[model samples]
Target: MAVSARRGAPLTLEEISSVALRLIDEGGMEGLSMRKLAAELNVNPMSLYHHVASKEALIGLICATAAHHVQLPPDDGSPWQEQLRELALAYYRHVRAHQSLWTYLQNHPEAVADRQMSIWQALYRILRLAGVPESELRRTSDVLHAFVTGFVVAETRGHLPDDPDEISRDFDTAIRLIIHGLAGFSS
Candidate 1:
């Protein structure tokens, strides 16, 4: 929709997020500013403030919106290793699909806590199920998260081959190794 079309309509948080995400996609984080977003939305710059308190708040909203797409594995009777693999792959696909959002999150780790909590919880649960001690839960979760994030970032940046089949194989292999290592921590 053109900016003029939205001139008089009340702006929704969803719209703001959509446009903001688009801006980031098109021009990276530097491209997203209150003025640009307002211009894109056909509203005054101040109007954006009505929906999002500040640029940082808008980034948080965008990250949360993107995080909504990263589904966690089901809590059924699946093996903990399998569950961890599914969660990591799901997270990898989501981050790979939204590279800009991933980069933004990487640069601003503080902005993603609210949205990242669910994913962390799922990982933590799987680790706990695998017999990870309470003393090592946080460390284990961080290690798993670091591996997934680092691998996906590298793969998306073409440091890894562009072949999906190859990437999938590599990802599974790495996940299995990580899972196996975690198994050592089980009581």
Candidate 2:
């Protein structure tokens, strides 16, 4: 973690991602550019290429770094329904906290699949444990993921209740509904 004298320190991948995340937070996905990031880091634009191959790669890195902050609920023999609720709430909080990055990642599902494989796998396992048939697991996962993401997006954007408690209540209601729906399809 030695700081370089140039630009107050040489850029590390972690630093790059941090600055990029900030850029995204402040300016939205369209605002982040290699030149802008390099300027922010006090380095030549080309220097960014040494760390990241392209803007898309940098975005993936930013998303992956953000994903690391999301805490997946542990499988501790809890009821599958409770476990899924925990997972959905955790994911909702994470996306709400990083709305811009999450929104950007939405357009690039392949990148998300590549970088956030662990999170995806965890969600898949939870759905399987809830007795989602093998044939329906993928669809169920997609539906649940979309629902959680869409709910948070709406809440964060003020489309939902302004009160935190109300939002939480609504979120819980939605989760229970989805879980109940899944129960109907479970073998």
Candidate 3:
């Protein structure tokens, strides 16, 4: 259904984010502008400001909304390594599903720098379960985050094979290395 702010009804942030995400998914961040979003929602360009202060804020809103959609692994008695692997794979799928948004986020560090992001928080929990010291949490998370994201970045940029099975094997190996490396921190 088409959303419209034309019938004396207000546009919800969810509506704005949904339409904005569709736009980014269609043409990437470059194609997303207040004017374009307004046109998509059938609202005045200035009306967007009521829900989001600026384009940056709108992107941030979308990021947060999308982040919530990522399925973090369940905390049931599963080993942390397994849970971590699940989390990594889920995140990988999310990135692949939203390549354009992920690319935009990769370019704009501030957009994904929120410490409260679901992915970051999930990683931190898994790392702590893996026995990383509190003092080393941030550093450790950064290293692991860089490793996985770097691999995805390379793959998305065509540095890796295009075969899905090959890519899955490569990512599986990477995750194993990460899990093995974490074993050293085991007390």
Candidate 4:
């Protein structure tokens, strides 16, 4: 069944965010236009503006919301390796699921400071747990984050070839290799 929007009432911020997110999910960031969003919501484009300040702000909110979807596991009982793996897989799935978002996220310089701190912090913790020196933790986290995010961005743009199981398997291999290498460095 299709839903229609009324011209009388404007969409809420959440509603606008949902519609925008859906648009990005369906098409890349370029696919998310105010007119397209309004059409999807079955409302006048002007009404959307009432809720979202502008297209840029709307995109920012969507990025923030997606960033919130990231989950970090408890550190007490779980091994750092397991936690990092889960986080990486979660990040991978998120990127694949919202490939459009990756396009916007990559180009936005403020993205790291603005909405992606949770992801960076988690990776930072994992690197620290690996006994990596504190001086290098931030730098290491940046490198590791870039590695995965770059992979996602390339994949999203179709720059990277698609292989059904390749992402997870290759990531798993890479993480294991890195951890093994870290162990040697520690010892």
Candidate 5:
């Protein structure tokens, strides 16, 4: 059995977030609770309150942490289409890896409304490269985000074919369609 935290040791938000994220990953959002987190940490439930105000707040913290883990393609002057494909694939993998959290995020737009998020920034950059005007940047990115997210959601929910190779081929086709569609945009 793992040893509990010593009475003198103070719990950190990192520790709390780590354990909470693990709980979320293992059992989805429904499985995580302050009590469960405390039990996992070997601390009093009240101790969690010292780090996060409530379950919602803790979830928010966990989401932010998860967002940071998403691998965004660097602005390496690559072709916009390639960059966009990389971005889409990275985002897809990230969300699929955390499906429960993605479901929560879909239901709660505010959770992902931060335009400064790297995912948003990467999308906006790719849109600009694709010649999307500043005025249309938000709208264009929103559409693309929706498309990729919706695709992965469907794939994860068993709505798509079961073969991994078939899924990849379908996704590539989808990306080509998106890029071809974006070709019509003008600055």
Candidate 6:
């Protein structure tokens, strides 16, 4: 039973990514061993090397997929404040959906992937939509991201004990607070 006898064709990158994502979902980033992933896909580990190269590359692909999910919609007629709020919420949703991987990313993103560039690009889009200058955008973006990540981590741990909906309400309140604070910047 040789590898060629199984499929007679190489697994495409998309297929590899899908399977890897499944492995990550089932078992957090730490559990995604190359051997286990290969076993799950019924493919040889060597075959994976041809597609992903390493676990870090696979993680990067996963992060990119997550980042794409939060890409902002076209400007349309939405107000900049509305756009910022939406962007923040969308990013929070992504972190919640991938909570375990998100923690892994926060701790060791460099080890897992080359995801920073794509993530920054996405954030830049949101900031530009909000009319934020590049110089101010970086710091403002960092604070917003810290807030989203911290909020997600806090929510998952049941940090706020009030109404279950309090989390969403609190997040909305936070967005409004930041917008008010930045109002004096004049663009």
lDDT tens digits by residue: candidate 4, 4-58: 3564554667777877888888877778899998888788777766666788888
Give the per-residue lDDT digits (tens) of candidate 1, residues 21-41.
Answer: 889888888898999999898
Candidate 1 lDDT for residue 125: 84
Total clashing pairs for each candidate: 0, 1, 0, 0, 0, 0
lDDT of 2 by residue, 115-140 (tens): 23667777888888877778886787
State each model's CA lDDT, in order.
0.82, 0.80, 0.89, 0.73, 0.83, 0.70
Worst 10 residues of 6 by lDDT: 109-118
Candidate with better lDDT, 4 vs 6: 4
State the local distance difference test value for candidate 4: 0.73
Which candidate wins on TM-score?
3
Ranking by TM-score: 3, 5, 1, 2, 6, 4
Models 1 onward score TM values of: 0.85, 0.85, 0.93, 0.78, 0.89, 0.82
Count backbone clashes in candidate 2: 1
Error of 5 at 97 (Å): 0.6
Candidate 3, 28-127: lDDT as tens digits? 8887999999988888888888889899999999999989989999778789999999999999998898889998887898987998888888888888
Question: What TM-score quantifies how close candidate 5 is to the native fold?
Answer: 0.89
The residue-level lDDT of candidate 2 at 164 comes to: 81
- Candidate 4 residues lying further than 4 Å off, grouped into runs, are 1-10, 153-161, 182-187
Best by lDDT: 3
Which ranges of candidate 2 are over 4 A from the true structure? 1-10, 108-110, 156-158, 185-187
Shift of residue 15 alpha carbon in model 5, Å:
3.1
